[model samples]
Target: MPSSRPRCSAGSSSWSTAAATPTSSARIAVSIERSRPEAVAALALDAYGLSARERQIAALLLAGLSTQDIAARLYLSPHTVRDHVKTVFAKTGVRSRPALTAALRPI
Candidate 1:
């Protein structure tokens, strides 16, 4: 079988970087920068003083989970999940998920 990855030529890269050569430190640095927002959001969430349930729901919200999905995962009803979401929004001082994300974003 032949490798699906393309040869590492000047103008072309492998179809998947997994089969490519090792990346440079600069790429690693960029990866770190790209990942910082999630860490920042998580840190901001922790500082909000949410209750255990509210924190769980808020974390799921940050992960982009829907109320039904969070309810299914946590064995709660959708109505309950929605109530938690609303409380989380109020506590975080944001009206919607995008606003919540923006509020938690790093300065």
Candidate 2:
């Protein structure tokens, strides 16, 4: 038996469906376009003039890492990470982590 599912054209949007076989069963495939986080971070870095270390710290901060966590990941002292966080806040004109995150978060 032939499947009753609708056939999707090549010009269709991200989501499209096609007949799998000459049977009642059909499979649907969906294509999703996602913005790269690195691209967003690069833009932010350029806009804010953040140093390489600062950008690294900012990325970790946005990922919900604490000072100690970020330091541990980077093999740095917690104090050093805290200093970078402070610099990031100052350069971004944000007073706190949440504010920095909100200011730099990708749309």
Candidate 3:
């Protein structure tokens, strides 16, 4: 039998990260194009044995936040966040944020 899952076009997915907007409210609003939940991604990352901090950073990365932004938001050094990210990638078998997100797409 063929797989029941819907066939998507090449390079397409049902979800996408939110794009940056000019206003805080815009930042918080979820659009149809950006409907993927961070929690689902977090759950995916959980299978990799990530620490709480590492999971948080992974979620932010999936949300398209930069290392500098993650550092400011979490009150850590950018270097520290990068360290966590390196560990995350090592454990998760991914080398970049886009690969990480793709690897962790919801089951």
In angstroms, the error of model 3 at 89 is 0.4
lDDT of 1: 0.68
| Model 2 stretches astray by more than 4 angstroms | 1-34
Q: Per-residue alpha-carbon lDDT of model 2 for 1-107, expressed as tens digits?
A: 44443323234222233333443356544333343545555576667999989999998998899988998899999999989998988898989888877776643
Question: Cα lDDT of all candidates, in order?
Answer: 0.68, 0.71, 0.73
Report clash pairs, candidate 1.
none
User: Which is the leading candidate under TM-score?
Assistant: 2
Model 2 / residue 38 / CA error / Å: 4.3
Please say which candidate is ahead in TM-score: 1 or 3: 3
Q: Pick the candidate with the highest lDDT.
A: 3
Instruction: List residue ranges in candidate 3 displaced over 4 A.
Output: 1-37
Local distance difference test, candidate 2: 0.71
* Candidate 2 Cα deviation (angstroms), residue 34: 6.2
- Model 1 TM-score is 0.61
Q: If both were scored by lDDT, which would come out higher, candidate 2 or candidate 3?
A: 3
At residue 34, candidate 2 shows an lDDT of 40
User: For model 3, how many clashes?
Assistant: 0
TM-scores of the candidates are 0.61, 0.63, 0.63
